[model samples]
Target: MANGVMIFMALYPLRYLKTKVDRLGKADLVYLLTTSVISIAVTAAVVVTLQNGITTYLLAGVASLAVWMSTAWWVGRSRTDAPGTRER
Candidate 1:
């Protein structure tokens, strides 16, 4: 569970940063810190609620990765389709 939560903590910043960069062209440190803190709090609540075994922990990480990737893909797609946004 802890490992899963840690993975969540680590992976979110990349997506958040990417999204911010796509929209703003630069990553804000305050935004990064705030999101990281929020992610930690939410993950802690989830970990406490689940209270399961190692398999659950691993599964949590996998699930989080999937969600993050899908969200990133969606955001990227939307940006490409938006007016004035060019595809690289």
Candidate 2:
């Protein structure tokens, strides 16, 4: 159990999710977390495909992370941004 938590803690995207927990509320939290996991998996695939060198793979990871995080945040915000609805 301890090992599993430490592995999850290593994911920096979860840190961003952590900061947004209060404002995002329960529903969006689930969305963001699921998105975060998908982002991690996709990033790993891209990094593995590169396989050129450490520098290239690292860049792939960073670039993909930026794209995924941005898209997730934007989608999450739009979903919660209806005229009659407000983040809680």
Candidate 3:
């Protein structure tokens, strides 16, 4: 699970970039990409410092996954063709 979270931390931005490709401008995307890199680095450092074993790993994984899912949903809803339209 820790390895999986590390992989996710690395690849998460690709998922974000693909999802927001149509909405974000190049500058905005670049900025977001930079931030994501910084965030991953910070998370890695924090995880190393915690050294608390599985509990910390599990919590970090869950927290990161939750943030990703919520952000995806939020960005997906921020722009729409119609208010009555349902998400596919």
- State which candidate has the highest lDDT: 2
- TM-score each candidate: 0.45, 0.52, 0.47
lDDT of 2: 0.57
Tens digits of per-residue lDDT, candidate 1, 1-88, equal: 4765676576657665434554423334444445455555555555677878776566555655455444444444555554456779
* lDDT of candidate 2 at residue 57, scale 0 to 100: 56
lDDT digits (tens) for residues 1-88 of candidate 3: 6676666666656665544453332223444455455555555665777779877776666655555445544444454532344557
Clashing pairs in 3: none
Point out the higher-scoring one by lDDT: 2 or 3. Answer: 2
lDDT of candidate model 3 versus the reference: 0.54
17 in model 3: Cα distance from truth in Å?
Answer: 8.6
After superposing candidate 1 on the true structure, give the runs of residues whose Cα lies further than 4 Å from its correct spot: 1-46, 81-88
Question: Model 2 segments beyond 4 Å from truth?
Answer: 1-27, 82-88
Lowest lDDT sum, 10 consecutive residues, model 1, at 22-31
Better of 1 and 3 by TM-score: 3
Q: Count the backbone clashes (under 3 Å) in each candidate.
A: 0, 0, 0
Q: Residues 1-88, candidate 2, lDDT per residue (tens digit)?
A: 4234325624644556545543433225556666666666666676677767767556755765675566565665567563345879
Please rank every candidate by lDDT, starting with the best.
2, 3, 1
